[model samples]
Target chain A: MKQQSKARAHTNIALIKYWGKRDNKLFLPMNSSLSLTLDAFYSETSVELSDSFEADSFILNDQPQNSQETAKISHFLDLFRQTAGIKTAAKVVSQNFVPTAAGLASSASAFAALGAAMNHATGLNLDLAELSTYVRRGSGSATRSVYGGFVEWQMGTTSADSLAVEIDDASWDIGMITVAVNTNKKTLSSRDGMKLTVETSAFYPAWLESAAKDLVSIKEAIHKQDFQQLGEITESNGMKMHGTMLGATPPFSYWEALTVEVLTKIREIRRQGWQCYFTMDAGPNVKILCRYSDAEAIQKLLTTAFPDNPVIISKVGSGVKLI
Target chain B: MKQQSKARAHTNIALIKYWGKRDNKLFLPMNSSLSLTLDAFYSETSVELSDSFEADSFILNDQPQNSQETAKISHFLDLFRQTAGIKTAAKVVSQNFVPTAAGLASSASAFAALGAAMNHATGLNLDLAELSTYVRRGSGSATRSVYGGFVEWQMGTTSADSLAVEIDDASWDIGMITVAVNTNKKTLSSRDGMKLTVETSAFYPAWLESAAKDLVSIKEAIHKQDFQQLGEITESNGMKMHGTMLGATPPFSYWEALTVEVLTKIREIRRQGWQCYFTMDAGPNVKILCRYSDAEAIQKLLTTAFPDNPVIISKVGSGVKLI
Candidate 1:
């Protein structure tokens, strides 16, 4: 049995947010989405299959995980074992530089790295396509982290089809400025939020129907390398997701005053003819998509305006790698 | 002309929110909405037409208003003169206990009172139906203030048909708890916001399609005096309006952090077997609908939790009246 195998992967921000689950068991999305793999946040993980190990043991960020987290990792390892045709127990350890469960897509990198490491440890050597599906079954968004730069998550009906595919290396002068609007833990988990939104939002059906059309336009924009078209659609798509959340039962909002403040400034910059726009995930943070040349300027303005908030500039990062 | 006339009217909270304009000039809504007139906030105005007046001079709260405010009132008065066949300028004095243009429906009471006072001053003797049309020409929601307690604004196709009709006097045990989340002036006018949403939101057409169905269900709920049904629909309707805003071209939200805090608290209370629900207007504040019996307890909780916020308990209020 392999002693150990390791891999690293970066998190990706959805330019077009994937809000709800169509099929929870397979982590199938209600609609297709697009994302950009980021350079800043990442996770590194190692997995070993050996008779010395009594059972599947997991550690994250230097701390032994609780039963729930351990069980989840164990279940994922079982899937890997089934594919590899091995009964050996595994010891898995992961380190995350990114904030976990704070809407920063930490799980994407974590699971993507896990998928790659397991493949390597078992000597299965699955390609990105198989690895993407494996990562998706663990976390829906982790599928996108399997590839670098710009990727598209297709809302396929079956387990085999619903996986992310690379659109571009994002070699164009495109970058993002991320503002840490709120790094605090969210009150509602994304899984629970998706469930609530799907069950209660009156506009969920409309959102589901419109996402395919948005995906089509966004893909064309990517192919054409049209920055304006991409930025406009990206911003609209994010807003549509939040709008659906607002229609949830009892209603809720992830936005803070600072989020709006950052958005207002982004618009001010855009009004000056800069190709700058913003997209927010389930958290209060705002990610501004702009030309690489303009990213520093936008970040500087935001830092000057809100010195308390950390501002980060990220480029197109590399794909998951076995190390 | 009659020497002088005076009237008072209360502000109304839309359980079913009014958003977007079908015809900006006529102040027509694209979808029907429902509202409850509240006793906590109102406007009192007195108008006098005399030969000594050279033009329409207006004083609000013992202070002269700017030309913009003057122009809006003057313009509304012109419509009244055209109907009465009189060309006399008028001196108008107004007092607003409600916050003006801050999403508290000050315009509803202002225009409803103006409509009644003007009709009386000119001896036109327009009834509630005719007066609703007149008030709507000034402010779309003012038509609802023409009637008392609970009101429904039908999204009629033309100027004459798009008028408010009384649903009931709200004699049942019902009330709302007001949370002053952001009493500051809004950055965008509701009129401008409505125009932008109507023009840009992809989900807007869906909203328009579903509004009539919501109206029917809410009306049935009202007739049955089913608090749960009415509360659920009201909460859903408000969320849908905000969701539409999120789909706007640049996208915007009327929520602040405290707004979410209040909503979270409301949901917590609801889970404890209470029939409390919330709705927000064009600003950050939230109005919670609850049984009159539960209003005080809810208000106390909010007041204790958010010491800086003003929490008020309100009951169903009367319609426009000559004073």
Candidate 2:
């Protein structure tokens, strides 16, 4: 077994979001989801296995995590240890290049990097598709982070079948601009929100249905290189996922005042004959899906409108790799 | 037939909102809805029948309406004229005390008063429930405005059965405060919005199911005078209705930046031990449902939070009556 290994993984933003979970513990999503991997946001994780270590330790961004955070990492590491038949404890250090827990899918890259680093450290050389099931057990969206460009996390009936598949190279003139409306940690985690929505929201079933349809059409759009169809489906699917939360008992919304303002500006931008569309996750921040040719122009307008917020443009990114 | 008749009708705020239409021409909703009539906003209309008039004329707020507006009223008046077996032309003078086309249900009071005035002018002795069928042709929500206090518009199989019925007298300690975020005309009318939502929204079927359940629960809450239960259902139902719009083909939202700000402020007010909740229609405005005893206190907080907007309080109102 290797003493230490390091891996880096890029974050992905879901065009068709995965909301409710069919199996919470296994992290099996109720519907299939598709995402575009971006070059701008990622996580680098290094795992070191030692027989002398009393317990697993996790240090994030040079800060030793508390018991709860460390325990979560330790629990995830056990899955790889069991697969490789190792009893040694490991020390995991993770650094996030994106905003943590602000609906930027920080957890996706974090888990993907962790999974890749552990697989190397524990001598479990599984392929990307097989490794994605393990990454999904960490965070559902992390399943897609195992692949590059446009990836789809199929909602298979079992853990063996539910895995990420690369749909396209995403070599076309497609990119994204992330508007950091708020970088603070979200009050409700996506896991908790999904549980609440599945349990209490009457719209959950319909969300699953719409997501299934969106996945099929989005794949077709990607194949046809139809930017308009792909962008519309992306925005509609994201909004529909958020819409389910509004029907939960004691309904909740992640939108802030600036979120609506950003949406209004995006609508105005589209009205000016630009082919840009906006999508949001479980936070107030907005992501504009546009052609790479118009990224600078759209970024300029967004920066002018929101001087306080950070506007980031990212190109198509690659899959996880050992560093 | 009487030379002239004048009638006044109060506006209503739906606790369980009516969104999509099952039958567009008849104005029949896909699901039943319940509402509370408010004393603050209303409209008064005076209708005069005459054989000398070659065409129908409409004067709203003492200003002559254009052909389009007059034609809409004239078309509504035709429903009443057919019932009364009259070929006489009518001069309709209508005045709205509330903000017009602002999602304040101004059309509810306007159409209700017109129906009452036309009924009296043509010597039709139909009861309030019977007249509601004719008013429904003007606007779906106007059917509920024909009655005072808590009223339910049942989504029956046909036009005659899909009429408003009084649920309660609303003698309890309950009222509402309207935070007029934007009183200007809405970009998308409710009629158009409903059609788009029903046809394009994938979440529309789920909305119908939820509305049916909300209607039953809200009615029970009204019968028991349970303010908390009533307030929760009101906010959930309204938010669910708006949620459906976000799933349309080209998604749209009536929410403005100030609208979300107002909702956040209301949530903060609730967290501070105030028994107040908010409900919104197809516009940016928000209405806070609170106990009459807490109405003033809640209104004061909202006014302090949004000093630029008008914060108007309304108590239980009466049904339509002739002048």
Candidate 3:
């Protein structure tokens, strides 16, 4: 039989969150955050041991990766090699199945998929927590993507303790509508942004303090399967994350004119008696969390409201699995 | 007594700093910040009770004031009327002697002088602390400008307790250099930016927790008259404040190309054994804190480095006083 290659993986979105780093090199966070792994948007990442190249090679979205772009991949490969006791080079090719132009947690799904695929390829028999640690080393949010359904990336003080855990299977009533304003890469990377917040913003401490409470409330809401509570917390957290940007000494604004317009429209829709709420992650795009039945109507409304923009409706997804 | 119509006040820079609000309407802070009053930059205002006009008028930098531009003054007047039981209208004209393009704390000076002048006009025997509280109700930072030399704006839980206090009457060796970059106003207002930070930035809490330490250390340095320590702390705090902005969800960058160039040059100069440090407020302009004797040389060096930019040099200034 032809050598079975590692399976592809997808990314996930955090309903709770994982922010800040205890260790820059290790990507260790000060606390854990919870998330829900959605089915519709994901990245298919396959890793295989290759003897041809001296270094790891990454092909992202069917394009050849540059040195800067593959840095994270190489870092992950190095860790994988150290763990698996293999000196051979590896090849990582990822095809993102996430909706075109949809602003979703592609990184979370991508890294989580990669983590699981690489783990399976190496036959490490690592537990979910170990897999999450490896995923977090690649991207902070990816740690939570290791499991499907409702998940949490616990902000443990140490890398050993900080790992993603499944909170609930989320097989029931949860749906999302991702409004894609632009699919172009963000101007600022989350890693660089987090570093900047640690170094500069005066209100950073207050954000950290409040986030813990938000995380706690979100967890409780998730346990109760309270979509309304979950949506509210997620939206509030998203807004809070945006707020820090405004207070940085010299100050910066993440808002495009369209961002405000979309937000206002979302609020208007919410006022119109739809059980819908919105959350944004590191981009101008907004994802509306609502009942699975409401997804179609919300998408239609958003499409009409934002005729120039594209919207993608998705259902609750499964965790990382071999394709 | 020439009607004692003209009054002048100087602005102050917060070395320790105060950020966040307990109450939006009252401008109460979560903690107090310490600052230094600079002799170099100040605003002079002449207020005269007028019977000609039905409303208070303001003239800024020799330009005629419009109603919309005088909103802050109007807000202050309304507050003053409620506090001091004053029913009369006044005409106010103010000139800022400080470099218009420089990012010095002009509002602090403007409001400080305004507070003093309004007090004089109203014959309200409000003490410095009470005056600070009153001014702070208008602008949070203005409270620190009430006192000269080393001043602190205590971030008390309530507006009544959150007042600016005099630390040391900074008679010692301290100098400042203002580097004018872009004269155009920033896109993000400090008020909105700070509010966003408090609401969003994940690193905000860490910043708040550590700020007290920074405040304590910098105060000790100021008490010991250690320019080196003072400069280091000020620069670090300024950088930290700017960092939070970058971490905001969509992320924002307040840096201009010139900011990078100037910062590089400043670092290069420091490597050449100069005891100079830089701090920036909400604008692209930079202010360097150095010893009195080194001010001229540093200014000359900076001017040479950026031939197109204007540099203003000034000494440690006095607080707001009757002219």
Q: Model 3 chain B: which ten-residue window has the lowest total lDDT?
A: B244-253
- Which whole-number lDDT from 0 to 100 does residue B304 have in model 3? 90
Candidate 1 chain A, poorest ten consecutive residues by summed lDDT: A97-106
lDDT (10s digit) by residue, model 3, range A1-323: 01125555546666555556769888887556677677787888888876666887889888999988788787786776788887766788888887666766567777887877778777675898888888888888888777877887777777787887778887768887878776777777677676675666666666777678888898888888787888888877766666565445443444454665677688778888888877667677777888898889888888899998988877888777787
Give the better candidate number (1 or 3) by TM-score. 1
Best by DockQ: 2
lDDT of 2 by residue, A58-131 (tens): 99999999999998988898898888888898899999998642337688999999999998888888999999
Residue B49 lDDT (model 1): 92
Q: TM-score, chain B only, every model?
A: 0.97, 0.97, 0.93
> What is the total number of backbone clashes in candidate 1?
0
Evaluation by DockQ, superior candidate among 2 and 3: 2
The parts of candidate 2 lying over 4 Å away from their true place are A99-103, B99-103
What lDDT tens digits, residue by residue, belong to model 1 across residues A1-323? 64689999999999888999888888988888889998889999999889888888899999998879998988887787898889898889999978642337589999999999998898888889778888898899999999999999887878888888899998899898888877877887889888998987767887887777888889899999999999988998888888988777757777776777778788888887788889988878889899888888888888898898888888888799988
**Proportion of native contacts kept per candidate:** 0.65, 0.80, 0.11
Provide the lDDT at B51 for model 1.
Answer: 75
Candidate 2 differs from the real structure by a C-alpha RMSD in angstroms, to one decimal, of 1.7
Q: What are the DockQ scores of the candidates, in order?
A: 0.52, 0.84, 0.09
